[model samples]
Target chain A: MNDERLERYARQLLVPGFGEAAQERLGRARVRVVGADAVASAGLVYLVQAGVGRLWIEDAEDVSPSDASGWLFAPSAVGSPRVEAARAVLAPLSRFVSIEPYPKGGVPTATLVFASSGPQALASAEAARRAGIPHVVVEPDAEGGALVVVPPGAPCYACARSTAGAGRPAQPGIAALSALGAAELVLMIANPESTPGRRIDLVRGVATARPTSRLPGCACGGPGAGAT
Target chain B: MSASAPPRVDVRAYACPMTYVKAKIALERLAAGERLEVWLAAGEPVENLPRSAAEDGHRVLAVEPLAGAPGAFRVVLEKGAGAAPEWP
Candidate 1:
């Protein structure tokens, strides 16, 4: 690795098993993010800091006044498209990573879904799974909600999503969930075959994790890779 | 048989954590039982690098002053099995 990259990701390189090889893997990752709203703010920042090679932000919504209350969007950026505004802020965080709006026919090594609604999260995650790549999905609610991790071949996020109806509007605490989700995705990118199918819930600031299983005959339990 | 000189890294210009980080990356590239020679400044680097390497399951073979280089030392390390058990 070069001096610039060494210094940029020095901390994670020190993580056991996160050697030069892992750093190179991270630098080679093309990660698509499904939302750039307040719910995705912290995760976008996390991905940039972790030095994923490319960030393809897939949001189509304008920044809301509430986005400024989150991490990335500037108050003045409200009304601009969220992906552009987010790329504007996240781009300067690390020169090692390339940030842009998602392109048509873009293929990502992994996906991160910080979807504002359940349907969007499900569809984004389903697409990633069908592509046979890793993905993480954040479901934010008023207190805090859940995030599902679907490493390739693991149970589908659709099977892992919360049974409860979409709970409430995203709360500030959703930052914890988003950041945690980003961490999960980073680890999966760094160690592709090691991530498990799981769900982590953050309710009123506490977090709990459990392994996820596929519904009978779910697509994830198809020909090759089966649910854990 | 006379042993070949081990791979070397100079961390004398860096401090604390980075000194260890540089040495660790050098170690990461080598196979288990391969030795690495790290050149670092005497005080903090001398005090920390050997301990850090040992803590990560590396063998601290020697800590000798660099010839004709003031306030710098050479730490020789042998790579250990797998990675540190501490981090999973």
Candidate 2:
């Protein structure tokens, strides 16, 4: 690592299990984020600050008025395309990470999903699982939310996600929850074998995490699964 | 095998944490029991680097001033088998 990178990641290197190796893994990762709106704002910010080498933003929505309530989007960012507006803000935060729209055939080493809708989240997580990459899905509900961490092949996100249907009203503390999700994603990207698949639920301010299990007859248990 | 002098890193220009951070990176690149010599500024860098390295399981063999460089000290650390940074 160079002097600038050493200082840039000085604090992370100071961590117990973290060292130059993990930081290098994070710096070399290509992270594909499935959403870029308000719900995905904090995660996107965290990913950039944590120094993922590349951020492939996959959203195709315009910023809504509600987006301003989140962490990254300024009020003026409304009416602009979600991915571009987010890139404008996030790209300035880290020089090492390349932020851009997700190319149609782009392949990422890891994925992060913070969708506004449940179906979008499910599809993105499934795609990442099928690709045999580590992924995290953040679903923010009122006051709190849940984040599904799917590390390679430790029981996929589809089985880990809560059955709560779409449109869970976003409330205060959602951005923090999203940031937590991003942190999980960063850890998985750094050391894919260290973390297991799990669901972390934050409800009414308390948090609980439990290891996930494969659903009966799930395709994830079929041939070619469990890549890691 | 004949023993040679340890690897050296000059962190005199960096402050508290980077002083130790650069030294740790150098230690990580070495095999077990390989020693590292860090040249850092006196006071905070000198005082903290040795303690921090000791706390992380590396053995601190020496902390002494450099002859030519005023207000700078040299620290010698022997890398531990594995780093065990203290936890709360």
Candidate 3:
């Protein structure tokens, strides 16, 4: 680590069990962040500030007027590609992190999915599970949101997510959930053994988490599971 | 056991957390039972470092003023064998 990096990450390095080794893991991580919107802006900024080495943004939507209310986009950036606009803002936050659009065949060490819909989250999380990449999925509802963290051998997102939650109008409070989601990913990346698979629900200002269990017949438990 | 010459870090130029941060990193590089010497500015850095290191399970061997540097102190810490903090 360089002198500047030591200074930049000094606070985190002081965290118990998260020293040079954890920082090295973070510096070597390639993270794929799916979806780019107001809900994802906080996670994107946290990941960059926490020093994830490479970040690939994978959203297909353009920045809409609603996105202007968030931190990553400006009112003038409406109609621009969401991923591009996100990169423009996120790139300047940290010099150590490399921000780019997700490539056609790029392999990510881990993934953070902020899908706009249930089906999208399912598909993205399933792909990450198949690839054996640890991942966290953010599901924001009207009240607050939930985050599903799936380590390599844990229950998959489909088995863990609540069945009834649906998309809601984006609000500023959701940023707290987004930041929590980023912290989950950081813990997963920094200390995989210490972070287990779990589902965390954020309601109002309270947060609750529980271990995730695989549903019967879920592919995550079958032979050749996570084989890709 | 006879005392060995421990690795030293000068953190007088930094402030509160950085002082402890540099000392912690230096301690992380050592094995349990090994000692580290940290030179920090007086006041908060001096007041907090030994307490924080002890809270993190390290042993505060000694804390005293530097021989020639006024308003500077040296802290000696023995690394502990405890595991790092895990997620909830």
The candidate scoring highest on DockQ is: 3
Candidate 2 C-alpha RMSD relative to the actual structure: 3.0
Candidate 3 colliding pairs: none
lDDT values for all models: 0.87, 0.85, 0.88
C-alpha-based local distance difference test score of model 3? 0.88
Cα deviation of A88, candidate 1, in Å: 1.1
What does candidate 1's lDDT look like per residue over A1-228, in tens digits? 887788888788878777777778889999999988888899999999999999999988999988888888878998999988998898888888999899999999999998777788889999999998999998887888889999988889988988876754656898888899999999899887777889999888899999998898787787886547
lDDT of 2 by residue, A169-189 (tens): 546688778888999998888
Model 3: how far residue B31 lies from native, Å: 1.8
Residue range B1-88, candidate 3, lDDT tens digits: 3467789999999987888888888887777888899999999999999999999999998999998999999999998877344232
Per-prediction DockQ comes to 0.38, 0.37, 0.49
lDDT of 1 at A21: 77
lDDT of 1 by residue, B1-88 (tens): 1258888899999987889889988887777888999999988889998998988889999999999898999889999985552222
Model 1 Cα shift for residue A106 (angstroms):
0.9
Clashing pairs in 2: none
How high is the lDDT of residue A175 in model 1?
Answer: 88
* Best of the two (2, 3) by lDDT: 3
Which candidate number has the best lDDT? 3
lDDT of 3 by residue, A1-228 (tens): 766888899888878888877888999999999998999989999999999999999999999998887778999999999999999998988989999999989999999999988889999999999998889999888788889999887889999998865875678888889989988998889887677889999989689999998898888988866421
Native contacts retained, all candidates in order: 0.28, 0.39, 0.50
